[model samples]
Target chain A: MELAIGIILGCCALGAGICMGIGAIGPGIGEGNAVSKACEAIGRQPESKSAVTSTMIMGCAISETTGIYSLVVAILLIFVAPGLMVNILKEAINLL
Target chain B: MNRNKRLFKLVDILYISMIILPIMIAMVIKILTTPLSQGISISGARIFFSIPFPVQDLIITEAQLNSAFVLISILGVCLFLTHGINSGNLTTRHHIAEWIVEKVQGLVDGNMGEFFKGYAPFVTAILGLSGFSSLLSLCGLFPPTSDINIVAGWAILVFILITYYKLKGGFLNYLKGFTEPIFVMAPLNVLGEIATPVSMAFRHYGNVLSGMVIAVLISSALQGLSSMVLSWLPGFLGEIPFLQIGIPAVLSVYFDVFSGCMQAYIFAMLTMLNISGAFPQEEYEMRKKKKLLKIKNK
Candidate 1:
């Protein structure tokens, strides 16, 4: 049972790492593309740089959400929830 | 937790005092200091609250309390339900569903169409939190939002709402969200999907609470600096002691207005995406990309 919990946790770690790795990829590319475009627009119209930069940041921020989610879950797995699960399982096993 | 329980009780009392003390202080200060400051009154502003700061005493501006109200109301709705706080007139947590169900009290409350399907939780949360804050304010409590916990509570609420929405698809859909095109990576995707909200909540909560802390510190520092410098002002620049207001004022704008609003918006956006991400196209892309990568590696 200790091994089982160990394996479960190991899997959780691997799962969390993968979520962050893959989740980050598309958003990273999406934001890079957004910034590049915004720069082009700004270069074309220097006076409109404020507007362009604002939109670019907004778009990039939106694009960044998935990465943020991946992070949140990873932290939760590492720090918070597993403790609760472990406690619950222990109580259940003792009851049994 | 024992310490936390005591701290929370202390805060609860302070929350009650916050609603009363500032107005009382301003009134007393006014009655006593009037005729001297030429009738200058803090009570001129209809709404005032304090975000207890490192400084001697930092009273949040009218705009700050209004912003705090908007923010805390959204967050308080969640704590009202989950944190075992006694909210409303309820004596106990037995009516857990009652708090959630009042969400549907919409359309009936002259707020027609305020009850929608997907946005239901978000709207209900906002309304409930705001209503709770309003109740506290009406009862002359400082609304607890001026306290950082209220802001953190809002962040947690968003996180929970997102997680709950996403989970409706069952763990299978959640699992598939990360790597479902093939059997190998399906498990990885599952883990990634789950971690999203935890990050979003912390980032947002940190941003908003820290931003409030910054604004208070800046204003207080500036207040102290201006008064001290005025006495030392070269007689030539005597007219310009308060001219340095722009420095702290600008910092106040960026920290309190821009960053604060952006953090709140990010919290909401992530909340919307949590459940919405369950749609299958994202998985299909992940799977397709995974297969393509495998072939290229081969």
Candidate 2:
């Protein structure tokens, strides 16, 4: 029982860490690419600076949604999944 | 002149006291109620009370209370800005109000075109409420936006508006829009449509909640570190979380201020974009033309 509980907790922690660490890379790269392109656009045509900037910000925010979704999942895994699994394991052990 | 000056001073004092007294009372109550043994703990919005019903009991949370306060304060600010408006001899408040209205109108016009000019107030209200609600965390209150239900409600409203505009073409047309280009894409389109509100709600809630979680973690870490490092100091001095003094403020500046305002702006922008994009432009133009012809005939 103790080993099972420990395994559940360790797996949850590992999963959450992996989830956030891997999840952040895509948005980071995507936002960097967007900002760089926006910078290039502004440099080429300074007249449309405000328009490009707002569009870039909006695009970046929308792209970040995927990263935020991963974060929510990771948070749930860390804070909620462990206790829930432990409780279920305990109940199963008692029934056995 | 002396009497008038004294009266003005009295009025100022009264105004200041009206603002400060409630805050002071609340602070005292909080200080008294918080247990000393806990040291510091971070959690979800505290439930103040619950009302019994036939089904589930309705619970009032700190988020609802803070959001209500934010709304009332926004109302007060609007009233103050719009008070005694006129064409001539405009006050600074009047100018501020005009500037805000113009900016919101320009944003709606630029993004959604002139057809959505009337939605400036709705956009402004969302921006104000979301921004203000998130910023309430700066004052050590539970930010309502950190609550999923609040943001979900807002996102669902925006989704409803989008759907309403889409249905304006015709319910049959709206249903047919799902199977555009190919029949197999219907499920994908429907999934995408449902994902809109879910993504919006989760995006805003997760950002704010993540910032708050980081803040709490950092503060608690600082507390632990301070006690560990400063354990050799005198009584109570060592117990004080000296390391927590200015670091959390810097984090709050980004998380509470910048992120809060940015999320609010993004939410409002997405709402405008989604709603306006759902509208059929050719139909709108046709309606406008028909109206013009009817007026000419009359």
Candidate 3:
């Protein structure tokens, strides 16, 4: 019983770590590309800084939504699924 | 000059405190109530009251219903207070409100063109409700947008409008759009259309809910860390939550102010873009006709 619980937990921890680690790379590159281009645009036309910045932030926020989705999945894996796992184990034991 | 700068800084601090004070009250309520309701054991857990009413007793629970009630009441109060705008002398409040209305109208006009400029009020209302509901979390009230059902309902409304405009362009064309590029892509196009609203609701709901969760975790960690550090001191003084005083407020700025406002803007911008995208050829023809008529008149 102890071994099974430990393995379940270890898998969850591994899944959450993988979810966040892999998820972050896409948005990080997207945001860096966006901000670099935005900076160039602002430097070329200083008066259009506000417009450029707002557009840049909007695009970046959309890109970051995928990262946020992965974070939600990681959070659920870390905090919520473990509680459910214990319940499932209890149900299994009762069946026996 | 130095004195002026100091005075400005003081005012900024005062304004931030006014914002933070309400959030602090909300945090206290959440900390006291959330854990006990979730069956987590902690000191003073029994004293917590679950703000949400029981769900099983009624057709719909009062939790989300109350949040919507709160939002509508706030909108009602603002409309009542501004009811004087049409009557007589232009008050400063009326002037500012009208200015905002004009700006929203200009935004819609620029993006969606003159034909759809009439939707400025609709756009403003969506933005106002979204932004206000998100901000309401700071006042210790449950934000309506946190409810997926509530946000999904909003998305459905936008979806209906998008469908209506698309059909208006031509029902035949709308049907033809699904099979474009190849016939196998029709199912994918249909799925893409459905994904729009699902994505919007999920994005907004997820951001706000995560922000709330993170704030709770950080504040609790701060309390524990402070208690451990202060253990070297004697008596109940060591148990006091010294770190909780002003630390969480810094994090709340990003979670509440920045994220709240940005999500609101993004939701509204996406709504406008999608709605306008539905009327592309219609708007182009309208503009081209006006230009040709102008040249003929000259």
Candidate 4:
């Protein structure tokens, strides 16, 4: 039972790590591309720096939502999951 | 003059660093005033007159004040800039501010006018309701927004607006709006008009309250796990002033500056779209032409 619990936790840990990794990719690339595009636009039109800055802020907000979701999942995995607690409680009851 | 220039640059940096500006203010406030430091750890749910609506919480925690003060201060600056310090006269700063305002105004002019106008009544009502959400949260009262009832109210509002507009648009014209030679969709267009606002409200409330829940759960879970783990690591040090006042600051930044602002803007946007789509202006023009046609048919 302990070994099964360990495996379940190990899987959750791996799943969370994978989630963070996959989730970061899309936002990272999208944000980087957005910055580069903004920089290029600003370079071409220095006067429009305000326009570029606002666009960058807006795009970054849209891209960052997925990263927030990943963090939520990671938090759920590490702190809130009850699988291990349930198993241990069952063990104590059986012993009793 | 250069000394004046250097002073301006410093102030500019202070203002631009949005997270720290508030932290510095909060720290000064913390030092000057003794904080109650005591949170009632309210259930975030309460009954009033046998109705299970979440009683608005008047939570006066440092976290809540930090958020509210920073938020209100920023609102003043953004909406009424001259109301505060003239800001650092950092050489080009005035121009930059004016330019920023212009661009944002341009964007608003491009999209928001038609959006806001047609949906004025609904938008006004939601704003009045949710503005109260902020007030209730500030005063240690349970916020109704946390309850499903408040959200259901918004959902019903959207449904009614959509139906009212569609029905008033007349059966044929409204059906035509749904099914035009109009693109690659007929039923999808009809479905989308409905799905948009309701989904928007749910996504927003779900996201906002979910953040609060996560923050609460984090502290609770840590209380449970603190015994097992390296107690040093959850390093709420971010919440501490020394190690990184800025780190914990980012959470509120996300919660308020990002989520709260986005949710407000989206609520306004959805309200506009839902209400406006119902009474599309073209319908009036169409009515005029139909009247002329009827006379000719006569």
Candidate 5:
């Protein structure tokens, strides 16, 4: 019983770490691509810097939502899920 | 640049304080007096002798209470500033107001076609509220937008509008939209449709909430770090949030100014696209043809 609870908590930790780390990669690359293009545009036309920068930031933000979604899941897994796990285990042990 | 611009800027700063001051007072009141469990209780009037005769203190969550305060304050300022617009000459404030109106109108017209140009006001209001609420966090107010319920409320409004427009286009067509390409994909189609507002609300709420969380955590960490560093010096002097000032201000530029404005713009943009997309394709074509004809005539 102790081993089972320990394993579940360990799995939760692992899942959360993997979720956050992997989830970040897509948004990081997307933001990088957006910023790079924005920089290139500004270099070509400095007058349009405000427009380009604003649009780029908006684009990057939208892209970042996927990462945010992952973070939310990871947060739930790490923080909220443990409580659920303990409750469920309590029920199971009660039945036993 | 000009004297008028500088004076207007000063007035803008003053107006901002006018808005923040009342909200700050409300917040301080909440912080000092609000109970731990039921934070900032406001008594609601007995309704229809509702099940339980005398209702106890209607507990408003700290976040909700603060956001309500922020919203009311914003509404007051909006009303005050916009009140003189109809009567006044094109003063600096008027120019600034007109400039915003023109920009929002242009965005609506350009993105959603001239047919939906009337949506400019709605779009502008949402964008303004979202941006302002997010920025309000800088003033130490719990930004209303950081509340999921607030964004969700806006999203639900947008969802209803989208559905209404879709139904207006054709009820049968709207029904058919749920089963596009194949009947088996109907659930997915419906889900995708529903996901629009859910995603929109969550995206904005998550972004703002994360920023708030990060700011709080960083400040707390800074307090700890400062205390640890100054351990030899002793006492409360070491516990001062010395690292909190300059660093958090720099971080706030990106989190508050950039992300807040960007989210607002994105929300407005998505709202426009979703609404416009609901319109029949014929309207778009007709608008295009009219534009071409006008250009040719010119």
Candidate 6:
């Protein structure tokens, strides 16, 4: 029982760490690419700066939603799931 | 002139007292409640009270209270700004109100076209509520935006609006839209439609919650570090978490102010875009033509 609880807690922490670490990379790269392109577009058409900037921000924010989803999952795993899994495991052990 | 100056000085004193009194009262309460030996602990919003109901008890939380306060303050500001109006003589408050209205109108017009100008007030309300809710964290209160339920409610409202606009085309057409290209894609389309509100709610909630979590973590870390570093000093002075002073302010500026404002703007922009995009172009054109015909006939 002790071992099971320990494993559950340890795995949850690892999973949360991996979740955020891996999940952030895509959004980081995507946002960087977006901002760079926006800069290039602004350079090309100096007159449409406001329009390009707003569009860029909107697009970046939308793309960042995926990262936010991962963050939410990671937080859930870290804060909520371990205790829940441990409780379930304990109940199963008791039933057995 | 002397009498007028004295009255102005008295007003200044009153204004200063109004600001300081709250802080003084709060400090007194804190000192009375909290023991000196205990370090500051970060936690979720406290449940103030709960009401018993038939099915389940309704619990009122700090988020609800703070949000209510924010709403009331916003209402008060709006009332103050629009208290008196005149065509010839305008106050600075009038200018500020007009500027806010113009900006919201411009944003709606730019994003959703001139036809959707009527949604400016709706967009402004969302922007104000979300932005102010998040900014409430700066006052050391639990921001309502950090609560998933609050953001989810807003997202659901936007989702309903989106569906309503889409249904304006036709119920059959709205269903048919789900099977575009191939019937096999219908499930995916349905899932995508459902994901819209989920994503919006999660995105806003996660961002604000993460900021809050980080702020709390950093503050507690600073408290520990400060005590360790200042251990060599004398009694009360050593206990003081000096490192917690200026650093959190800088973090709060970015996390509370910038992130809060950006998320609010993005949420408002997405609301406008989704609602506008959901409206079928053909239907819009037909309505436009009908309106034009009516005007011409009149």
Best model number under DockQ: 2
Where does model 4 exceed 4 Å of error?
A: A1-36, A49-96, B1-128, B131-149, B166-169, B177-191, B217-250, B273-280, B292-298
Give the TM-scores of the predictions, in the order they appear: 0.39, 0.89, 0.79, 0.49, 0.78, 0.86
Candidate order, DockQ descending: 2, 6, 3, 5, 4, 1
Clashing pairs in 3: none
Q: Model 4 interface RMSD, in angstroms?
A: 4.5
Any runs in candidate 1 off by more than 4 Å, and if so which? A1-36, A42-55, A60-96, B1-191, B216-246, B279-298
User: What DockQ score does model 4 reach against the true complex?
Assistant: 0.08
Residues B218-251, model 6: lDDT tens digits:
9999989999999999979899989999999999
Across B175-264, the per-residue lDDT of candidate 4 in tens digits comes to: 677766766698788787766555555545555565566545554554445434444546563333242224434564565446655655
lDDT by residue (tens digit), candidate 1, A1-96:
697678767877887778778878988999999999998988899999986875677677767766656665765665456677677778888999
DockQ of each: 0.06, 0.88, 0.56, 0.08, 0.49, 0.83
At residue B150, candidate 2 shows an lDDT of 89
| Rank order (by lDDT, best first) | 2, 6, 5, 3, 4, 1
lDDT (Cα, tens digit) per residue for candidate 5, span A1-96: 788789889999999999989999999999999999999999999999988987887688789889989877876787678879988998999999
Per-residue lDDT, model 4, residue B189, is: 86
Give the runs in model 6 whose Cα sits over 4 Å from its true position: B1-42, B284-298
**Fnat score for model 4:** 0.00
Task: Please report how far candidate 5 places residue A64 from its true position, in Å.
Answer: 1.6
Candidate 5 residue-wise lDDT, B170-284, digit = tens = 5677788788899999989988988989989989987887777677667677767877777777677766667766997888888888888888999999899899888876644
Give the Cα lDDT of each candidate: 0.55, 0.87, 0.76, 0.57, 0.78, 0.85
Q: Estimate, for each residue in B1-298, the C-alpha lDDT of model 1 and write its tens digit.
A: 6997798677655555554455455345335533654421122223345657786577654334444554544444344344444443554443765655564443223222222244655545544443443233232223333344454556566556555644555567755555657778866765655456445545554344344445555656666677677766677564454835567566656655565446544444445445354434455457668889999999
lDDT of 3 by residue, B1-298 (tens): 6996687567556545544454455556556556454531211112222444576332343235434554555555455436456657787757778887888888888778767878987888788778777777676556667666777888999999899888765667789888989989999999999998988888888788778777788888887899899999899989898999888888888987788888888888889989988875764576678889999999
Measured by C-alpha RMSD in angstroms, how accurate is candidate 6? 4.6
**Distance from true location, Cα of B125 in model 3, Å:** 1.5
Query: Model 4 chain B: which ten-residue window has the lowest total lDDT?
Result: B42-51
Task: Give the local distance difference test score of model 2.
Answer: 0.87
The TM-score leader among the candidates is 2
